[model samples]
Target: MNKKEYLEKLESELGQMSYKDVKDIMDDIGEHFDEGVAHGKTEEDIAAGLGSPEELAKSFREGGTVASVLQKKQAPVQNARQKDTTASAIFVILFNLFVAIPLWIAIVCAIFTVGAIEIGLIAGLVGLVLAIPGFGNFLAAGICLAITIALAVVFVAVLIILVTKYFVIGTGKYISWNKKIWKEGL
Candidate 1:
């Protein structure tokens, strides 16, 4: 089939995609077909070289357009809950780094330097209350703080693993596998 005929067939089969998307994909297939034809291949040879129409449609549906793929290595996954959870985890991590750790240090310093355990306890309690959700209408802020702390911790651990993996021989292979799985939507 010619490029236009192949595209029309693709459009009919994949009804949900936009015309522009189909056209762009067809253009890519046409380029490959043209290359094969230049090399003395028949139309049937060109079509087979491009692979099955169903497989091509599946790639477009899951991977998005070539333009979008070039813009970002991996398409964003389509799970709303997953996105929310990732956001929450990241928030918890930041909270731990900036708020929780500093407050804990201050409390410890107060107890040792000034010999004022009561003062330290009071400050620590205040900090804990502020950190806890539903202690006031600041429940949302508390929730955010918790999430930030959690995500920060996870980020740190991942960073450490990445660094160590790259430096170590066998560990680097595992690191490469982790990245591949992440990219492939596993």
Candidate 2:
């Protein structure tokens, strides 16, 4: 089948998944098809080499989360810490397993809380435009309100960037922890 047909079949197979997730998967595979075509391979050739989308989708479903898919895609860092024989290094890995999750939850919660507070501050500023005396000029108030809203949007965008950065850092750290815990036992 053609690229479109193959992806459609895959999407149908992954019917229960989020549309965003399916689109991301299709985008990744589509890039592979593009690369193959660049090298003079046909869509059918690419699809055949990749195997049936149904089976692929089934494997992904069995894997559970998007994080698993992501971890599968990214390669391991070459200079991954050696099986350090130090005492604190081992302690840190074990301590992190239980501790880091709560830390991540707290970070996520803090980001949410900060975003909420910023938006609430914007709302309060808008209210102040009506409540305050000299600052109540309609045109000025409208402009200030728009500026405040824009700032809030920027704040959220920054939060998204920060959270994504945290996710990447956390994923690498977890991989290191897994290696230390499973590969090099105490």
Candidate 3:
């Protein structure tokens, strides 16, 4: 049979084997066929030399079982440590993305709050200058200035809170915790 037909037969017979494992074994068998062809063996001769697919699959399963057992025995301690490190790393990354990024964004928004106030102040000053001869104009400018100053103060406060929470609390505590976990694992 051709390679495709042979692979299909193997897949049907190997009930629990992964497709990748079956494919790898098929590749090895294909290589043997190629070698036989190079040595002037006919397709029939090559087919006769290669064992049955069912038998080959049993061998593959046996090998897989032995390998799995060996793998578990060889690295139980390392595997436990690797699992801990992986969990810690994931926590650190998630904390940075959710907590740190949002905190930093809040701080940036706070800084921009001052800029918004400055813009408002400039606008108010322009209005004041235009209203030079009118009491109404002065009153309007004063209101604008008050509103701007309030916004600036609120923004400054928000920025301070965000910076303190991220740098002083979240980062300081979690980063050190992550480092300690990594060192202990190593």
Candidate 4:
């Protein structure tokens, strides 16, 4: 049989093996076929030299060289990938405790302060309008000054609100990223 046919039959014979095991076997066999072809051997000859797929699968099941090699290759790779996530978890916890929480509290205080200032401005404007008769001469100048200052405060409050919104969104995204790293590794 050709390389493809041989591999298909071998894969069928390896049905009881784990996916990784079967894949390793197939890859090794395919490489042998490639090397044999490079040395001017036919696929039939190579497949014959490798022996029947059933016997090969039996050898693999019986802890053959391929099985041993697969075990050796997987052991080191699994260990290498098995990272300790304790550091990342600790960093996130410490940062939230020492930095993020304080920043969030400060942002909340700023928001409340801005809201109060806006309300005070509105009340002052209402009071000024009500006491218009008493301010006769200075009323126009006072009104203009109050309006300008109110506009400035309103602008500042709006900016703070926008900044707080983005800060919250960015913090949420950062927390989500940390959570992903905790689960999946960095």
Candidate 5:
């Protein structure tokens, strides 16, 4: 059979399919013929090598239906969504690296410094109690100073615990958000 006969046969066999499918199939087959002719092969030889149009139509119907064509059509959209996801991932990573990480470290160091201050206050209170006897006429003043230091310790301890707890919760939520973006995309 010649190229025209083979394509006409294929088109007739695929008549039940959608217009887009039929057109795409015809275009592909036409290109095959063109390529074969360019390669110095005769139309009859190319049609023989391609097998019967009925068999080609049957294979297309069995395995390459609307689903395959739809997937091809959706490929660009899927690629665009993937690009969006990639951008989100890059933003999250960069933000974590440049802004979030440094800020987190600074807050943690501040917490530690506050903790050290609390320890120092406790030590001062202990020292006041130990030096009370040596204060002599100023023993009342020493007691008042010890009470102030003790109060400061309590205040700092409560502040640090609350801050640390909230910081941890905030960190967990941020990490979860990052995971969600990674898994589900933008």
Candidate 6:
């Protein structure tokens, strides 16, 4: 194939990709052609070196998602679902399958710890409420319960923050997988 036909085929094969990606690939190929011509390389020789457009296109498509990592601008993550319920359900099912066990364990541990603290707080609160007048001091109990409640709130908040951070990471991975699966199926 001639250089023009080769580049056109490459561009057409890559038409479904983002314009920037296609443009970038074309630019690189254009550079290669120019450099080869400058160095007394024939169109046939350059085309041979580049291989068939279909094969080159297949390589590009099969390659890792380069555009996913490279960008001068980051798009805001839109939470609105453009896909139907089945795909959404599948994503959820896969998500749970991948992370449910460890996620549940962490949550259960946090809940149990919080439950223990709540039990202690309730006991102290009950003691404060039921204390006989002039028999003993309720001041210590109230203060302790207040402090424990505050601490428990902070502890639960920390757990939530940690869990949320990891969940977002897992979600990003799931989205990537879903995109790959969709592309492959197409």
Candidate 2 has an lDDT of: 0.77
TM, every model: 0.31, 0.35, 0.32, 0.58, 0.61, 0.34
Task: Order candidates by lDDT, high to low.
Answer: 5, 4, 2, 6, 3, 1
- Candidate 1 lDDT, tens digit per residue, 1-186? 665566566667666878788778777777877887799898676776677777777777887676777656544544644675666556555655797568656655643553344345445555755668555787777777666655654565565456445535544564465455444433
Q: After superposition, how far is residue 47 of candidate 6 from its true place, in Å?
A: 0.5
Off by over 4 Å in 5: 1-73
Summing lDDT over every window of 10 consecutive residues in candidate 5, give the lowest-scoring window.
59-68
lDDT of 6 by residue, 114-169 (tens): 66776676666567556534345766766666677667656766766676678668
**Residue 135 in model 4: lDDT:** 85
For every candidate, C-alpha RMSD to the true structure in Å: 23.7, 27.0, 14.8, 11.3, 11.2, 17.0
Q: Rank the candidates by TM-score, best first.
A: 5, 4, 2, 6, 3, 1
Once fitted onto the true fold, the runs of candidate 2 whose alpha carbons sit more than 4 angstroms away are: 1-94, 118-136
lDDT by residue for model 3 over 28-88, one digit each (tens)?
8788778888998875667666667677667767877878888888898788888888887
Q: For candidate 1, give the lDDT.
A: 0.63
Put down candidate 4 lDDT per residue, 1-186, tens digits, no spaces: 989999999899877889999999899999999999999999999999999988987778787676688899999776655554665567778878999889888888988888888778778877776776688799898788778867876797788779888988988997898797666555
State residue 174's C-alpha deviation in candidate 2, in Å.
Answer: 2.3
Q: Top TM-score: which candidate number?
A: 5
- Candidate 2 TM-score to native: 0.35
The local lDDT score (0 to 100) that residue 41 gets in candidate 3 is 85
TM-score, candidate number 5: 0.61
Strongest candidate by lDDT: 5
Model 6 residue 139 distance off true place after TM-score fit, in angstroms: 99
10 residues in a row with least lDDT, candidate 1: 110-119
